[model samples]
Target chain A: MKLSHKELEIQSGQFGEVRKLALEHQMQVGKFFDAQSFVEISQVHIMADTEALGLAGIEYLENLAQYPDPQKQVWVPTITDPRGSDFKSFKKIKQNKRFVDLEKRAIDAFKQLNVMMTDTCINYQVFMPPVKGEHLAFGDTGSSIYANSVLGARTNFEGGPSALAASLTGRTPMYGLHIEQNRIPNKFFNFNVRPTNFSDWGALGGIIGKQMNSYWDIPIIYGIDYKPTSDELKHFGAAMASFGSTPMFHIAGVTPEDHLAQNKNPKMNNISLSDLNNFYKSYLPKDDNLDVVVFAAPQLSLNEMRILSELLDGKKIHPKVSLLVCTPSAVKVLCDKNGISKKIENSGGIILEGVCFYNMHAREIGEANGWKRLMSNSAKIINILGGYGYETILNSMEKCVISACQGKIVK
Target chain B: MKENVYFGHIGIGEPVKGEALVADDNFSARYDLDRINGNFSRKSHKLFNQSYVNKILVLNVAKGGVATAWMFRSMKISKICPKALLLNFANPIIAQGAAHANLPLIDRFESDITKIIKSGDIIKLFPKEGKVEILNEKSTN
Candidate 1:
């Protein structure tokens, strides 16, 4: 890969150890992917949850924090994805002290490097949505997909280290999603049913995700009757990315990229309603009892918060079941102001900010709380929690709330 | 010494030799692994309950989660990780993670790596050279 004089200086340690490390990290990733040069990225969203980072990752950050040069601060406007533990609710959620301490240390290290603790996967919805054709260094799969497909921004799956490196260097290796040639759709799907709700959208996405199965697959979907809401697309894109590791998808006449996609109909596979039903049915629990009900993964948007509050209002969650509501801190403030958080909390649901359930030492929390059976509206989270020893039942948001009230899934 | 050589794309990290733990299933450190135990813990995974420590994991592809990129580094620090990863198809996350962890990972082989490699076979990786040698194979007879 070719380097600029400024990049050479950073590599030569003229800018200090932090920039040097960042450059080396980018160069390593660059050479691996055959990136010819670096592309300047406008912003970066880093997924540095403490669980993923662990003590070793945190210690690595602390080592970086030891550098005193302010010149080593992030060159771009960098924010964070959801943290592993929400400090305000970690103890209540049964997260251990070690988890909390690691979260703090990681945050401190990031702050030292001038990274904002936005702590959200839904940064596109709450904070700032990247514009069409804008290049970014985004970490979360959901964020990358949404930004790429929906908003028409460009980003590959920039992980914690890569995103942070892009932050410090203000540039990322020009490969993968950064190049325009790779954005073309290879797989086409024609759906039989029009998805009306968030769950339907998610269910459809899961089927497509399973079918696509590879990161290189860009599925251009057709036959949707109407445009989905941001929240609906959130669930859809998040589930697709989670289930398939797919980065970008195009929805006919809806997403921005669809217009740029070739007009010639790529050979399309017919996706029937039964496929969606079967996908949902596959995750259904055998037993009726519910240990927990969660409303997160991509974290809740404001509209989702409003709807959840409306459902929980004037009702009580079953004593035997625990309901968790995960949202971004910024959105939580609005939910609080709108009394959405209060309503859910008053009905026995815990509204946690900045941390999704699966990333918060899920296995340990489940063991500590004795929670083995779980239900959630997020197809992404339910798919993930299964691996963490939870028996998950994937259902619609409405069905999930009803399950919370009755203390078991309503079959 | 019987050896069958296979060529792959230039991978990350130094060359190393270890027994193969081949599976047709896709991988994600966040979705399919118990990092602390160095084992495949996802019940539905093809390699479920199998220990991956010190082995050359030959798999179909990488699936889901950007967390795997950092996870390789975290797993490496604790010494609870596969010695190398050889997948038929590689994603950006897998490549980035391999770079971060300095874990030898080669992908984009001429054929399905999982079909070529079998469990318990001795395998050696030459990352810079993009070459893999199946060092020892038991005869079918």
Candidate 2:
């Protein structure tokens, strides 16, 4: 890859050993992708929860953190994704102290490196929304897809190590979605039906994702009668990225880059209502007894929190069932200030801040609490928990709320 | 004893030899694995419940979340990782993860790797050379 003078300096350790190591890692990835050069990135989001980091990863960070040189700090604004455990409510979910201790160590290491602990996969929604055509290195697949498709910002799915590397160097390999020609749609989909709720939108994304199950295949969707809200697209993109490693998508009239698909004739597929139903049918409840009803994965937006809060009002949760709601710390602050958190808590639900469920040592916690059957309105979460030894049920938020109250799957 | 060789794009980590565990399915460290038990745990996956430890995993492509980028290193630290990854195609997450973990990974083969390679085939991978060689042919049973 062609390196600028500053990049060459960083590579030569003129900055610091930490920055030089970061550049070397980026160069290795860039060479694998055959990236021609480095693109300066405006911001970066790192997704290194303690569960994923393990002891070695934390040690790696601590070694980098020990470098006290100002040049070792991140060159661009850097933030974080959801942590492994929510300190205040981890015990409520049966996550033990060891996990929290690891989390604290990871946080301390990040702080020493001058990284911000935004702890959100929904950073595009809650924190800073990237402008159109901006270059960024975003860690979470959901956030990367949303920024690329909905916001028209350019990014590939920057993982934890790569994102941290980019944070230190303030640039990433100029490959994948960073280039304009690659952004054009290669596959087309026509929607026969519009999504009614967030879950339906997620199902739509799943159908399309399963069809175009590749990082290289970009799908251009058509026939949406109305503009979908940001929260709706959040579930849609999150599920798509989960089911398929889809980096970016285009909605013919809805998304900003739909015009890029105008002159190309890509293979077309139609997504029908039956397709959505079949996607949901694959996750049908086995016996209806539910242990947990979670509303997370991409974490909740303020609007989703308000809707969930109202859903729980005047209702009591079943003593056997646990309803866990996860949101970013920023959104949780707003929820607390606006009584959304209190309303949900009063109805026997637990609100976890700065933590998403799947990454929070999910398998261990499930075993601890004997949580066998899990239900969630978020299609992304349901898709993920299967490997963690839970029989996941997918449904709408209202139905999920009803199931939580009754401690069973609602028909 | 005839050996068949195939070439791919030069990849990450050191060259190594291991028994191949081939599948036409895609992979994700977070979505398709029980990392604690070192097996393919997702029931829908073709290699469901199969142990992947110390084997060369030959798959179609990489899929799902960015957690794989970190999970690979974590799995390596715990001594519960595949010997190497041989995919027909790799997403950035897999490539980045293999780099982070210093695990051998080679992808973008001239042919479908999963079809050409079978489970239990003794294979040698030369990542820097972008080459994979099978030492034994399938026996007629």
Candidate 3:
């Protein structure tokens, strides 16, 4: 699984330990496959959550600290916090000293890695989209699949291997996503109506996920004319994958390769459409009513922040309900830099750092706050909330803003 | 009373002393064992917070051994530490009659059927469980 001499020494000056970790982690992964492991990986896309890993999170930076081997891996550090997570919550982690010392050890490590640190995974708009026949190694599960299906990039939910391979030996299992001939469409979708609202996207996504379970298919979704926001897309992507284990999808006009581009429109094997009655029967749980509205799972994008700020300008949050927003520190810092944070803060929404409603285990945060009827401007938050309570509802950022201002669902 | 079967390595045999349990593969044991419905990690899970118990746990398949074996050993060490004899997630099940395999505190490891099948049909060619069990292999593969 070793590369040519030139590739082996490609990351020499970057950060030695960072280099070692990358080689170790990725090569170890390479050993799993019988053949073509090192040749499989091409490009790297990072979807980071440093706060979650605490000290160990630095291990990621350590790996990133190196330049990638050519003739092998090209890495993209997708989104990261502007600076990095504050060392406060991370100080509590007991298992990692290497990571705790990251500030001193790895600031140089990040300098070596060539990937961009865009702080937002909710939107995959910043970088070059993976081409029709390319195979990529991406970490964000939703994005990985989205890139694979919509953008026509090839990748598995193969994060650890992809990340490691890019860092160390710079390779992957070529058997899965690397092959060009294997990149054809799988599932065919016939939409009943164009999804015009954020919830509409989620509604359609929910149906698609259920339709394609544990399989990869090309779903050509028709009729999605309204402008789709990042949060809406993230929600739809997560829900479709969570329930159905579906890895990829295609929205006729939105994705890189249209379903029509692939060898003629195959039969609509998987149907993803929404109308008033069926959307309710399929998406809205009988028990869902809406208690509180939560924003930020991957955290809200900058545009979302501005929209929310203007919406909540003069109104008070529902006296009985609560509105909470969690943004990665990087975005918060940017907002702080631009004064967007203060706008959101004055508008009555708290833009906290580190912890999010999804990964956090304490339901008390959701329950103790007395947000029995949960509403979300975010689809990611809505998906996680769906795990614990049945009353959660998914809505667009605009609808949520109005609800927050009016203190009710329809205000 | 419907005796709920927890097919995980969390609490395998010690429960056998007086507790009830069953041995199954890891993937199904984890995924098929729904949390919201309280299948494996039901109300009794209240005794602990995590979904699965500890000690003798099942592997993803007695083979295709990746995160299953070591993770269960980890679970047994702390996360899902159970009260009884440890059960292993093995194929041609780890002869339940074996004694040391049921040691109250020792974590028994087993692999899933899929792995064994995928790795090879010639069973005799496989590596020893203890040897494969020690690997902290990276995920790049």
Candidate 4:
């Protein structure tokens, strides 16, 4: 990898030890990918949940945070993804004290390093949305895919360490999605059915993701007559990224880069209505004894919050079922101010802020609460919870709410 | 039996030698593993329920989210991580995680690594040199 004079200086410790360490790590990754040079990044989103960052990771951050050198801080605007626990509702979710303490320690460390605690996977929806062709180091797969595919920004699926490295140095190695040639469509998908609900859209993404499983696959989707909402694309991209580790995709006449699909012939696969049904069938609930129904993964947008609030109005969740509604702090604040939180809470639902369900010590919480059969509207959450020992079922928001009321699988 | 060797792109971390756990499936520390148990816990994974601790995990590709980047270090700290990773294809998340954890990882081989390597086969990995050598062919079965 070719390093610029500034990069060389950083590598030589002209900057603080923190910057040197960050640069060295970046260089190793860059060389692995054969990156040619470094590209200046405008912003970075770091994923540093306590669950992902265990004691060693937290100590690593604290060690970097203790650096007294002024240059040890992040070079560009840096933000965070969802935290491991929401302090206000950790106990409600059965997360122990140790988990909460670890979360606080991680937060303090990130603050010392000058990172904003956005605490969101839906940063593109509630936080600063990246512009077209802008360079960023986004840590969340959902965020990276949304920015790369929907907003036309350039980024790879930067993991926590790599994103933090980019933050410290204000640049990332130029490779993968940062290059133009790599973004061109290689796999094509012909969409025959238009999705009616969020889960349908997510199922669509999962079907395509299962087929285009490689990180290098750039799938171009076609046959959509209407423009899908941002929330719809959010579920689609989030599920696709979760299921396949995919970073970017394009929807003809819908997403910004559909023009790239023209004149380019790639292997074509058709996504039919039956494909979506089979996807939902694969995750069908085995029994009616539902322990929990969750609405999260990418977290809920304000519009989603409004929709959920309406669905839960005047209906009480069954005594045996626990309903968890997760959203970013920004959206949660709006929900609180507008009484959306109260409406949902009135119906026996708990709203967790600033933490996605899967990252918040999910396995431990499940064990503590004796939760086994889990239901959620988000395809991304359903796909992830399986490894956490949950018999996850995918459904629409309406069906999930109804199931929570009946305490069983409605369908 | 002949000693077989394969070359791949130069990779990250120290050279290591360990038993191989080969699978023709993609990997994700968050989605396909039970980190606390040190086993492949995802039911759909080809190596489901198999213990991966300290073995050189040979897989087809890396898949799923960026959590694996932080997860590798966490798994290493708990001493439950694979000894090294040898994949036919590696995404940035795997490369970044391996670099962060300093776990030996080499990928981008000319052929499928899972088919070339067998479970329980003793193998030596030279990550920086981009070399993998299978030892004790008798154990390949």
DockQ of each: 0.76, 0.81, 0.06, 0.81
lDDT of 3 by residue, A213-297 (tens): 2333445676666556656676677656544445566677787656344647366643444343364443344552455677755
Give the per-residue lDDT digits (tens) of candidate 1, residues B44-130.
999999999888899998888988888999999899999999998778888888888999989888888889989888989999877
Q: Which stretches in model 1 have alpha-carbon errors above 4 Å?
A: A263-265, B1-3, B139-141
Worst 10 residues of 1 chain B by lDDT: B1-10
lDDT tens digits by residue: candidate 1, A239-355: 999889899999888998786567494688999988878888898766687899988898999999999999999999999999999999999999989899999999999999988
Docking class for model 2 is high
Clashing pairs in 2: none
- In model 4, what lDDT does residue B40 have? 91
All candidates' lDDT scores?
Answer: 0.88, 0.91, 0.45, 0.91
Off by over 4 Å in 3: A1-35, A39-43, A47-118, A126-135, A160-165, A223-235, A259-291, A327-342, A353-356, A360-364, A367-373, A388-391, A406-411, B1-51, B54-78, B81-141
The model with the greater DockQ, 3 or 4, is: 4
Worst 10 residues of 3 chain A by lDDT: A90-99
Ten-residue region with minimum lDDT total, candidate 4 chain A: A259-268
Fnat by candidate, in order? 0.66, 0.78, 0.00, 0.78
